[model samples]
Every structure is written in structure tokens, then in C-alpha cells.
Target: MLLGYRASEQYNSYYKPVYYRLAESGGQERLRELLSQTPSIQIYDTIESQLSELAKINNPQRQLTPEEYKVEVARYLDGKDPDEYGVWVYYPWSQKLVHLLDEEEFVQVRTSRNLYKIKPEELETLKTKKLGIIGLSVGQSIAMTIATERICGELYLADFDTVELCNMNRLSNCNVYNLGASKAVITAQKIAELDPFLKVTCFTDGITADNIDTFLGTGSSQLNILIEECDSIDVKILSRVKARAKGIPVVMDTNDRGMLDVERFDLEPERPLFHGNLNEEGIDLTKLKDLTSQEKLPMLDAMVNLSALSDRMKYSLSEMGKTINTWPQLASSVVLGGAMVTDTCRRILLSETTSSGRYYIDFKELIK
Candidate 1:
């Protein structure tokens, strides 16, 4: 999986980063062996730069010269083995070795500006919460945004599909190079590159009745908030049902007209799925799994409020199998939806927002 030289994936090693602590026994030797074996390894060590920034943060009044900054970095290490100063992260897929400050310092320097906006206490508390995101087209953006913000300590990603050329139109984390990789794997790798400390669990097979219980969690392993963005009609209804039963909040983004829907199943256990969009008589949610994509169009329309769709979206929907192969999704809408959903989730997780209803951030309407 490392660029051109493919190693037999007996251990699925490409998706994870291997950490090397030179001070530990055999760590230095192992790292050296890895470097020697990989002919096209890319080395990236910015520990000195990070140390300089750390010094500035610690002593804002002092402006150190070049030589003084060097001294400051050495002083910071303070006799600690320079090789063991920070973590050496080896990303298998890209065959890149990255040097980063350990978790505490890395987070401090990485999220220093967010201190007041997120609040030091809130950021710490947010690390204890667990969130799950289903689907990866728009969910990829949501996951990347959440990871970049360090909004959750643990994240669960479920996507049954692989990256395709068409997905790159909206999936920012994917590219032509990794066209056949699992969406969940691609997202997880991206998150790892951002913050190796954050725990991520991937359901590459996507969620089904079999793994639903485990994904949503049971007892102490439950998710604090659930974000559903899958294209499956059955999953949309089924996940809500499960989340409602567990009193977990569910948030979603339609990537159309900036629609963000929140269902606080935790607040109201009796809340109807999709805000009662599927509650009408003769529409059986249980049978949705048995229907084809074309057959499920009516339910999809009702759930998304066909009448309220933007004129362009409505027309696009009408041309799903005619003029267009599927619903059109631009990169702009997907990115905006990611931000909208992340903000809503942060607010909900921090007890800053509790209302459950559909909200629109339609730029055309707002700007006018």
C-alpha cells in the first residue's frame, strides 16, 4: 500500500502508522531497519519548529535569536535523548516518516488558538465523548472537520463502499491514487495523519442488523452522539430507531440547500424517525430494505421533503436515471454541510444546543 512498492497485506499494515521511540529497547534498531528496507521513504521531522513555537508560547515576552532559539530547543529537551525527544510516526501507506511532539504537547500547540472558543475545560471534556458517522461521501468531510477540530476523543466510521472516480467530486479525502480503497479506511488514514492519538473504529462493511448493536454500543461502550449520512433508506430509518432506543442524539446533513437535521433521541425517546417523514400510513419502514433504489424513490422523496427541494435539485432528482446518473452533489455543498454538522454536534455534545429540528444555512436565501 506504500505508493508503488506493495507489501503483502497480511496484517492490514497500510492503514495504520507505526510509532518508533528511539529511546526504548529495539525501537531505534527497528526504525533503522524500516528505513533501510523501504527504498522510497519520505522523511519529515518538524520537531525543532514545534519546539520553537512551544518556547514562544511559554515565554511570550522573550524574542530569541537564531542561536538562542537553538539553545531553547536543546534546553527544552534538557538531557533527554534527542532521538527520543518526540514521537517518530511512520505512515505505511505513504511511506512517510513524520516526527511529531507527543500527544499533550502536540494537542497544545495544534489547538492553542481554540483555547477560548472551545474553552480549555470544554476541549478536555470533548475528548471524553464518542461519536459515530455513517456513510462517507459527505460524511468524509464531516469526519475530517471533526478530527481537525479534535471534537471527539473517539470516532466510529462505517462505510461499505470503496472510493470511485465519481466520489472525488464531493469526497475531499479521496483521490485517483486511492480509487479502490475502502472509504472507511481512507477516512481513518486521513484522521490518523491529523492526530494519531484520537481513536477511530472503522466498519468497512457498513452497518447492518448484525453489527448495529456493537457500532451504536451497548452498556458502557455506547456512542455519545450518532451522525447518519448514509444513502441507504433502510439505514436512515433503522439507525434512528436504534439511536432512539438508546437515547443517543442523531445529526444529519442532506448536502442540498444546506439542510442540517437533528433528532435528539436522547431528549425525546418517542420522537418519530426522520421527524415523522415516514410516519404516514401505508409506508412500512421495515420493508424498505427489501426495496430497490428506484422503488424507494417515493420514500426518499417524502423523507427529504421533495416539495421543499431547491428548483435545481428537484430537476436533478427527476433526471436521476435519465440525464444524470445520480443526484448531483457539488464540493461546495458537501464542505458547507460538513461544517454545519460539526458545529451542531459540538454544541449538542457540550450541552450548548439541545433543540432537535431541521435547520437550513442556505446561502442564496441568507445572503439575499
Candidate 2:
């Protein structure tokens, strides 16, 4: 009964949020009418909490008594209609209505905790940037972390696969309920719930040679950076090829021992893809698509530095197609990879770190 679901209405279509400004003419009447007709409506209001936080920001010198707080609130409103203040957001998927400050105020109070860590100017700059993420399994962590940080204004998510029981192990955002849903859709919905103001575009069919140009952007609105995490050997290499052509930086985390790759294609236009790992193995990029699964192992090995991998990983690789059905990944590593990639991408966007190389953040080596 949620949102009067029909067989024809796809779940992906409900990820967007509807907004109503009570200050606008007839806004309250429209919302009241809808609520009256709807059998189930969950309303939440947190505007007062937001106002208290705003008051603190303005009057950091001293605390306010309850009476003084009311005065401060009145001063802040300045005779504006209380019901008309802020914006009302309705989520169709959950049938939940939430009231909160508008985009500018919401962002300021929501991200106030990150003040010294992320300067105001830097956050403003980041809000104007766009990032594209491929392969939503481990990429989920990266995308969520970026969203929590309010790092970018828009996100482009691409993944051709759907959620499966096996993916729940490392994909924290996925659960049994989403087993049959598209990975990109799940991620987009989670992001919308977290911050409806942020923009999210889903590539349900995932990225391919056909749409790579549009994914990387062909016009003035190209992606600022590309996060490559797809499983396909072809896409892993192909994305970098297209990214390099557009002078967009690319970052990847192998989700093993914190192996991170940063390719500053924007800076080094001619840098070898994957730090030339394939070239070292004498593998030809042109013939990569022709290689069988078994034949592609060498390239994959080179891409992740197989010899340097932990003993358990090497053992897992040997057991693939035998003991285990596919490459093994742990929740801890995948989450760490998300954090690692998020931080790397943030720095890349802010120009804090500029280099092209493969680095390892092996826990065993660092913790000990």
C-alpha cells in the first residue's frame, strides 16, 4: 500500500523526494489535502533542533536560558510564518514526511561539525564538483562516506549487477530485503534518505564502452574524478582509458590489505594505466577482451600485485572456482577500502595530494 504501488511502477523511480515550501501560496493547503487522503502518514519535525544549533553558532559567547532561547528563536524568525519556514520533504518509498531547514541552512547546520576539518570555502568548492563511482559493492562504502562528508554536490553511480546473498557479507548497506534489487538503485535510495538535497543519477545498466563517453562526460559538465571498482578486467582498463582521454583523475581500492591506486591523469595526461602494471606483465590491452577467465588471471594479478598480497589472499586466489566460488573479500577490508578511497578522492579534488602511484596500507605492517 506504500505509495499505492502498481506492478508498472518500478522501485527505482521512488528514490526521489518531493518538497513543499509552506511559505509559498497554497503550499500548506496542498500538503494538508494529501495527508488527509493518505491512510498512513509518518510526520517528523526537527526544525527546533536546527534552530537551537543555529543560535549556538550565532551566540557562541554564552549559553541561553529557556526564556532567552525563545527570544533568540523569535529574533531568528523575524515575523516569518513559523509553518512557512524551512522545507517539507516527502519520501515516497517510506511514506515519511520530514521538516527541516532549506538547502543553505540545512547544509550549514548539518556540516557545522566539520568546520575546522573542512574549511567553509573548501566545502563550498566541493559542493560544485561531481564524482562518478562504478561497481557499487565496495563502492557503496566510498559513496556513502563521500555523502556523509558532503564532499560533492552530485554523484553518478553505475553497476549492472543486482544484490545477491553473497554481496551482503561486504556490502553493509545491502540486506536480504534488497537481494533482488539493482545495486545502483539501493545505493541511490540510501543516499537520498541521507541527504535529499544531493543529486544522484543511476546507470542501471552499468558503464560500458557504449556509454563510457557520457559517464565520463563529453561536454563542459564532465566528471571531476572517477572511482573505478568494477570486477570486469575490461572495464577496469577501459574506464581508465576513457578517463585519461578526458584528463579526469581516477582512484581505485582493491579491497585487500588497503591496496589503493591513484592515477592523476588530469596532471599526467600520458601516465600509464594502472601504473603500467599490465605492461610489466606484457599483456596487450587490445586483446584483453578476448582473454578467457583463466587467461585474465595474470592481468588481474599484475593489477593488484599478486606476489605482494597477503598469504591468505594468495591462497584464496588459488582456491577460486574450487573451494570458494569467487574472489574472497572481508567486511573489514571493504569498509577500510571505502574510507581509503573517500579520503584519497577528497584530497584529489581539493588538490591536497597530487601523484600517480599504487600504495598499500597493509594493517599488519602499519599496526605492528
Candidate 2 ranges with C-alpha deviation above 4 Å: 1-10, 280-290
Q: Write down the TM-score of every candidate.
A: 0.92, 0.93
At residue 83, candidate 2 shows an lDDT of 67
Evaluate all candidate structures by whole-model CA lDDT and list the values in order.
Answer: 0.87, 0.86
Over 1-368, each residue of candidate 2 has an lDDT whose tens digit, in order, gives 76775422345556678898998898999899879877698999977777878887768788888888888878777898766779999887678899988898888888889897989899999999999999999899899989988889999999998888988988898766677778898898889888989999999899877888888886668999999988989888889888998999999999888899999999999888778767634646667789998888777876788888899998998898888988888989988988888888888889999988899999998998
lDDT of 1 by residue, 217-303 (tens): 977689999999998888887888889999999999998889989999999999887788766566565687899877787778756
Candidate 1 RMSD computed on C-alpha atoms after optimal superposition onto the true structure: 2.8
Model 2 lowest lDDT segment of ten: 5-14
Clashing pairs in 2: none
TM-score of structure candidate 1: 0.92
User: Where is model 1 more than 4 Å wrong at Cα?
Assistant: 1-13, 61-68, 280-286, 292-295
